[model samples]
Target: KAEVDTSALQNEAIQLSSASGHADVVKLLLKNPRVDPSEKHNFAIRRASMKGYVEVVKILLDDERVDPSVLNNNAILLASRYGHAEVVKILLTDSRVDPSADNNEAMLWAVENDHSGVLKVLLGDSRVDPSEQNNYAIRRASELGYVECVKMLLQNSRVDPSCRSNNAIKHASENGHVEIVKILLNDPRVDPSACTNYAIRHASENGHVKVVKILLQDSRVDPSVRDNYALRHASKNGHADVVKILLEDSRVD
Candidate 1:
């Protein structure tokens, strides 16, 4: 017979079982009507989800008494941050789960952690807004040179390719992500002169010669714009190769 204990005992057992990924123990404890799923800072499901205990998560979700929506700093958010794709998938099935909740903060967490697997799951959900302003996902991905993540986010129809906040192109250029720069530049909506022509300036300052050349190829980019900030940055940073390239542009005053 399953032992039904007091609230405190049940809470402790549930927390330990969930944290340890003890699916069997969790199942047994959850069967008790006295066991509170929301106990212990609402960590029961969050811990299981974070650790990628798919079976445990399924068990918890299946219980009619369990409030799957208990965010507890976002169970899905924690799952995504830790790169638990399976766990994230389970959470998405809950109708109350908000992919864009907390200002789409979960997606930002996934991007910052470079958890593309979890990101993919999150992006697939129509509910997840890809264009949250200054959310570090795209910016961080571009800066760190995560080509696939950038591509995925771009393909999502909801995401604006030329979001100025944490500008993707500028971050890519600043971090010397040549391929990413090319990708963003190819997007017709993206403005090379956006962010006060920071794209070119970043490429120049970082000595990303390849990226600089790519940006210049875009006819819309006036290298001499912003008092030739790109040129100045290249010179100041001692990026001789970038400076050489800039000098060749007739637009440079």
Candidate 2:
């Protein structure tokens, strides 16, 4: 039978040390004969990884007793989600670590949180699928107005440049991300007509005159399409600048 009292104390000490990011405490505690570092769960490593404790993580990972492959509460996922780029890099060195594990949730979390530093590391790895159609990192970055993130994802050949199902251009326009709008507009694959009048309408409705001007410059975008949707939205929303720009198109009825 396990020494219940000793085991409880060890577990509590390790967890606290890991959570507090005390590398010295973790090392000293691991030296205790009664402490079972070999526990399959490896709670210490997980906590250290999640908290971005680089030294603590390294110490825990070096222990042969700690298993990095345990599926539940994945260390890499947590580290990536929290934007711990250094911790993630350290974890990736272990053959046991699967950065792409957990259905690419690590990458998705990195994208969602705008962890650009972590994202660079993740994108360079062959294991990360930047173009996972279902996850759509590009779409998420575009919608969130992460221009740099979007640019990085676009470099991956797998990612579709066109504003497809995720409405990359539409969301960027709606949120008035002018730079992102410019980038998407410059992509040949992106059809301005793809979102119907969504791009101009949302830009107008939100009173984004600059974005409306950028869209107007795109010869592919017909401002008067959808029964003059841009004009109606700009007029109704009291966006005089956007309305004036739309009316100048000469196609507004």
Candidate 3:
């Protein structure tokens, strides 16, 4: 019974030390052959990854028995989600680690949460597919105003600024991300009026006066498209500034 209790404590001990960056303690605990990381689903490595404990992660990865890709690459996901570039890099070096694990969720979290560094590292890995979900990374980054992240993803040949239906510019314009909108426009592939003028309507309805003006400036965007949807929404949403801009457009009746 005593041995059974000690075995249980081993997993907990490693988890605590790994999470706290106690690299030395983790090493000592691992010396005991009974400390099986897989017992708790390799959570200790994940904790270290999430905390950006470079040394702790390296120590754990060095152990041949440790599997960093367990639980659908949860370790890399946590590291990428938390913007731990160093931890992600170390984990990638492990032969068993798949950077594209869990359908490339690690990169998605890094992109969505504005972790450009981690995203960059993940992008460098050929295993990562930036365009896996129809250019999801670029669109989300544009919408969230993550300019740097958007730029990085845009440079990736696989990513399209304007995918089949959903577009990065459309999302950016809707949320008044001026910088991102401009960046997307610079990409010739992006059609500002991709979604039946919904981009302009969303901007107008949300009272994004600056974004509305930017859309109108683009000759390709039909201010009066969708039966004058942009003007109608602006009026209904009580966006006087946006309404004024729309009225100035010759196309808006």
Off by over 4 Å in 2: 1-6, 38-40, 163-166
lDDT of 3 by residue, 106-210 (tens): 999999899999999999999999998877888789889999999899888999888856567877888899889878888888888877877888999899998
lDDT of every predicted structure (CA atoms): 0.81, 0.82, 0.87
Error of 2 at 144 (Å): 0.8
Q: Which of candidates 1 and 2 is the stronger one according to lDDT?
A: 2
Best by lDDT: 3
Ranking of models by lDDT: 3, 2, 1
Per-residue lDDT for 140-238 in model 2, tens only? 888889988988888888788663643888888888988998898877888656667688778888999988899888877788878888888788888
For residue 151, model 1's alpha carbon misses the true position, in angstroms, by: 1.1
Off by over 4 Å in 1: 1-10, 31-34, 134-140
lDDT of 3 at 137: 85
Task: Give the per-residue Cα lDDT of candidate 2 at 168.
Answer: 88
Better of 1 and 2 by TM-score: 2
Winner on lDDT (1 vs 3): 3
